[model samples]
Target: MTGTDQQPVSASLRIDGKDAELEQRLDDELTAFNAAATGAGAPEPLSVRVTDAEGALVGGLTAWVWGSCCAVDMLWVRADQRHAGWGGKLLRAAEEEGARRGCTEVIVSSFTFQAPDFYRGQGYRETGRTEGIPGGHEDVHFHKVLAG
Candidate 1:
């Protein structure tokens, strides 16, 4: 080749129309994968049962079983029904259910504004604590071993 002559040069740039579609499909797949992973690892939602003493559903409790333990998610009695042992009754019911489900222990969590001492009075021991959540609030965790 002469100094003034030029050799052939080859170059290519591919733009597939399906590339965007493929990217979108991959994104959808990743999203589905992430959701499935999270759902499979997350604990089940608490199951709740309510009771109406008269015309009002004043007493209720929520719980969930995890492995050999049950979590008492919530226990509430009406304001007017306090000090009537309804709370203990509800807790006992939840414990019975937990035992029936092969749970050997029960755990309950309550905020500083709720029934921390009440649980202690019912044979629950404070196992954990977290302070300064959100609006300057503290949470207390409690646990109790079930009777085999």
Candidate 2:
């Protein structure tokens, strides 16, 4: 709609929650735009999973490689499998895959009560932290350069 000044008016916004179709549409459009703008093409999903002998899920990592960077979206291990070094193994696998995809670095984050120390132990350095999260915890960010 055109406003009184004869300019296009912005569409009305809503707060409806959790729309998967809309989410996918937004992701698709943004990916197309990013590829067109940056010439980096599309992001490649990189997942590293660990399982038991029976193929039961134990731990995994989900990340994406875009341009020269790999962004770790989530890394989780089963409660029964925690501290067994599966997390590190999953991360290393992801990093190796990211490197194979032409990424030179990886970025990840965790909550204060989560695996900040784990990432540190994996040679990730804290880039920043956002305080005032619920329960007085902070969301910590980390980065690591992949070895050649």
Per-candidate TM-scores read: 0.65, 0.90
Supply every candidate's count of residue pairs whose N, Cα or C atoms clash at under 3 angstroms: 0, 0
Which runs in model 1 stand beyond 4 Å of their true positions?
Answer: 1-50, 53-55, 134-136
Best by lDDT: 2
RMSD of each: 14.0, 3.0
Displacement of the residue 24 alpha carbon in candidate 1, Å: 22
Give residue 55's error in model 1 in angstroms. 4.2
**After superposing candidate 2, which stretches have Cα over 4 Å from the reference?**
1-6
Clashing pairs in 1: none
* Per-residue C-alpha lDDT of model 2 across residues 77-109, encoded as one tens digit per residue: 999999998999999999988998899999999
